[model samples]
Target: MPRFGGPEVLELDRHHPDPVPGPDQVVVRVHAASLNHLDLAVREGIPTLKLTLPHILGCDAAGDIAEVGSDVTDVEVGDRVVVNPGVSCGRCEYCLRGEDSECVEYKILGEHLPGTYAEKVAVPARNVLKIPTDMDFPQAAAVPLAFMTAWRMLITRAKVRPGEDVLILGAGSGVSTAAIQVAKLAGCTVFTTSSSDAKLEKAKALGADVLVNYKAMPWSKAIWELTGKRGVDVVVDHVGEATFKDSVRSLRKGGRVVVPGATTGALLELDARYLFWRQLSVLGSTMANQREFEEVMKLVFMGRLKPVVDRVFPLEQARQAHEYLGRGEQFGKVVLAIDTPD
Candidate 1:
């Protein structure tokens, strides 16, 4: 976007020059780019994210390798791949410890650097993973950010176990779409809330055992009653101030609430008594570490997990795509097609 404000600020620069790879980087001929709530946040100029004006906005991408750096050897040109958007200095202690998200200089694709909203983008060679020929570019693009973040939140931070009661808030989001499936595959009885009944129904097909329309009724109370007043074991909430307190309230004693992003304002107040008396764990998470990314993408490649893409738009219509997402009408992800195959 030219300047942070709204979707109107986004400009389609079709004449923008393609990127050149560094010695450790590779140039990708981008086919598809997926939108995240993060894209909207960065566009609006979050105070903490300090992005340069006229930022390119897209965190998840998939395409073919167009050029390889001299030092790159693992993959060659013409390889179909998905890019891992998280970037960290490989020399950092956190990266060495497999906690790349905590690196002193952690950067995400599009957020901290030039992003995937172009015909081509340059990313570190290690960031691209080859995808099976059967997976199309738009589908591959939908996998990176949402799946990686959800994997870390559920498996790494929440440590969700089999037969647990897990609640996923905002079933319409990309992360929640991935979270519901991940929880189900882990054998959890999932509960999810959405304002739209159609979205909730889709969540059911994704293995959500309880679907609550938060618009029609208070979701926490409904979940509490559904679980026989015992509450659930884990609550996945990224909605922030709008649902943070209710998310905490829906958890059972010693239960945890995991968050990847806060789409709503972040300054939500929490009562210390709720934390102390209930022994609840509220964990904050961002994009995944490399280890988590690889592990999760393996499942995505194996077709054991799937990405839900709500709509597709051509690159020139990126501003309209962002506005569509901002309206919260999409049931899952909104992807932009850059170099779609003939």
Candidate 2:
């Protein structure tokens, strides 16, 4: 898949085996891989990413260690683990200061480098998180990217407080599903928007306190009424240009809007007066730090946060998986299951 444009670009080709891991790397026998909106962006091609042709396109996975390089320590062959895609040079000043996501050379696994959509992938030992013995590969595969992005945006950047109200835009998105659960865990009331009734039902099952059908109601106005005209304490918005202004209007004075992506088009129009007068904060967050990843995964393992998987497709059906996700009807993560058993 060197080419770009649509899911058709994801062509399957058998090439030479992936090289053996270097000193600090390990090879994983991939079991399950999950999708994200970022996958769509990469498939369509982004301005910042300049990659070699025929790149892989998955960001989240859970697998067993097949081979370990000589210098690898703390992990061994047959160990079960999940891949954490956010990679940063440990020597960078930001990483040194414990802000790894802000590293000058931060890169993600599937986008910038070869990814785990294949049957096997090699990753730095530092980028792998050990999974609990009792968990399944598909469940573990759901944790890394979506949950981490949600955790960083809601907990770290937004500082979502207990008992507050939070609104998550686009209930069909993976991050939105994660946000609903995370917000509920924080003791917050969650409101979510969906274009479909079926998706709204699924969102409610995940602990959403209020559901707004964007087709039936003006979401911002509905949120205002749902909160008794006070609006919510925070809004988790990744819907971009289509919903950004509505997201802003749906917040209370001094409330914050945390954005981790722009799915619905990027260029947004805003009123300067609303931003200044309302004392609003628009926080931008990407992926999570190592500590955050560790913290959130612990919860996932403990069943405190469950990754909602919408569907799983075979690895060869990558194009179909992308098409399903691109349709925006999925209520949770769309995963690609590697048929090979580990």
Tell me each candidate's TM-score: 0.97, 0.97
Where is model 2 poorest over a 10-residue stretch in terms of lDDT?
11-20
Residue pairs in collision within model 2: 2-54
TM-score of 1: 0.97
What local lDDT score does residue 26 receive in model 1, on the 0 to 100 scale?
A: 96
Give candidate 2 misplaced runs (Cα > 4 Å). none
Give per-residue CA lDDT, model 2, range 1-342, as digits (tens): 779898988987667376589899998889999998899999999987898877887889999998998999889899999999888988988999988899999888789878889878888888887888889898888778999999999999999989999999988788888889999999998999988989999999999998999898788888888888998999998989998999999989999998899998988778889999999999999999999999998889889999888898988899999999998878888888887653
Candidate 1 C-alpha lDDT tens digits along 1-342: 778888888898756777889998999999999999988888888788887666788899999999999999998999999999988998878889989998999998888899989888899999999999899999999999999889999999999999999999999999999999999999999999998999999999888999999888899989989988889999998999888998899899999999787888787668899899999998988889888999999999898899999999998889899999999988888999995443
